[model samples]
Target: MSDLTDLLTVPVLDRSLQGALKAALNGKAKPPGALGRVEELALRLGLIQGRLIPSAARPVLLVFAGDHGLTRSGVAAFPSGVTVAMVDTLLAGRASANAFARVVGAEVRVIDAGVAADLSGRTGLVQAKVAPGTEDASVEPAMTLAQAEIALLAGARVADEAIADGANLIALGEMGIGNSASAALLMHRLAPAPLGDCVGEGAGHSPEGMARKRAVLAQAAARSVATAPLEVLTQFGGYEIAMMAGALLAAARAGVPVLVDGFIGTAAALLAVRLAPNARDYCLFAHASAEAGHRLMLEVLEARPLLQLDMRLGEGTGALLAVPLVQVACALLSEVAELADVLEAAG
Candidate 1:
């Protein structure tokens, strides 16, 4: 959304049942607050569901893939083509995300937001191409406002489809070479974090490589002057990131609990929050990444992630790892036998 006010029609989570949800948690056999974050998570889920009975049981992970013009500038360790190749790998169900989805029993959905290469015939690919990719932000705005709009709309559509398919929990993920550079720029714009502090050795950049990235990104930031959130997204965001931002807002709009992945996905969530500050209430920060800037972004949002795995892998794998926790939280509220209920039945 160009202005977050435009998207305020998206419903905020109704907390009418929070009292009952918490009472249920406290009434369990364990002492009050004994379940720790588990109680908090369950209560949050109930608030989102608008009922004491909640379920994040049927979850879907959407992996948005794109190629970045900045990848041509030697910003990333791998070639831009790897973006497309990795999509193929994900479709083959051999990617790390796929393995983890199996662990959490979540379905994986891949969307081609703006991959540079032709992936027309690829089965299991959602072709929502905004462009082959955006122009190199170091040289020019990465995308037109229209392109950013398209990406945002496409992302929202993906979330709508997921929700339609019985998905109550959605995890965000992406594959875009040099997207880390894009994410770093997003952080510098939205937060007071210095550009150097936001820069990280994404995907194994060497010390020298990281310096080059920091320099290039500073220029990109200087070139970008848009104060509006969508304009900022157009200036420096990757297609996959743009879509994820849209998807996150859409998920929040649909009242679906979002399991946000690390770094790149977090950047998307960051953009969504900037567009709609209330969207933050809908997201569950999945984990903190190994990336240095990740903590900076997390701090900006005041997000406490569920896991501290030093992982920088971007395929929604981190978010997938957190899915079981969500399921267990749902089970705690929906299936766990309460102390009062047991005692009443025995009496």
Candidate 2:
């Protein structure tokens, strides 16, 4: 029953095993620094696990879907209905995230946190609805403080369930239509960056549409009374983003590294880091998204994502694609032989 502030107090990753892991990596059959970042990735895994040879199995990608009232306005190019449709696509294994998850042998779990439409009784969907959808932030606060807390807690619970189900790695993503607008606002607020820099043609908004989007977001930001991170999240962020922020903290608390997805996911990570600064240690940015705001958000987080595929898809596809890279890093630590061991075997 701990609150967000209490949850933020999760212990930092233990670094006592770093020396042993580094020694083991250096002693590997490969030449020094030959594996490059993979070796560094291996060391990070060990630090998170407090082990010299960390391992990962049952990687899971949790995609949280919601809707924004702004979609009903003219901020985005696509209709809000596309959010629910994409969720269906995700559930049917036809979406890009599904395809990537299959390739990585990772399980995909979708959550209905705040879709505008009813998605209950859907097979393979976790029902943790915070609301039908958030209120239009351009006119008012998107969600109440209590509802925001609920979304955050729901995210933490979903993450707890994933870990309990034996997932050692979790990749977080979102699917709220007009959410890039939401993410843009959150980035502007949290990164304290230029509004113009944060605005993007999410869902392929045309020049005119992008300009309209910018205007709508500007109005929303002026109305935003979100001074604190939680306030910013509650007033301007969607349920998916709030939940992912909570999920990021929970995953880090469990000492599991989160493969944070694109712009939307990075916004959540930014809020999580703002609330719990140590949470950054538990996240691996999945990619540098093509979204205009994502690079600045990633820069704010000081993250070097595993890939730069120029991906902007928000269904956790980018994160899922980076899964094998992390798994391979863990595998290398466990399977690669020490040069001394190799020499002894040769003798």
- Give TM per candidate: 0.96, 0.97
In model 1, pairs of residues that clash are: none
lDDT of 2: 0.88
Question: Which residues of candidate 2, in runs, are more than 4 Å off?
Answer: 345-347
Counted clashes in each candidate structure: 0, 0
User: What is the per-residue lDDT of model 1 for residues 111-169, given as tens digits with 9 covering 90 to 100?
Assistant: 99999988999999988988998789988989998898888888988888999989999
lDDT for each residue of candidate 2 in 1-347, tens digit (9 for 90 to 100): 25766778868778988888898889989898899999889999889867777777788999999999887668989888999999998989899888888888999999999999989788999999989989999998899999989998899999999999998898998887899999999999899898899998777978889889989999999886576898998789899999898888998999888999999999999998888988989888889999998888888888888899988878898998888899899988888888998889999
In model 1, the worst 10-residue window by lDDT is 1-10
Instruction: Please give the lDDT score at residue 119 for candidate 1.
Output: 90
> What's the lDDT for all of these models?
0.88, 0.88
Worst-scoring 10-residue span by lDDT in model 2: 1-10
Best model number under TM-score: 2
Total clashes for model 2: 0
User: What lDDT would candidate 1 get against the real structure?
Assistant: 0.88
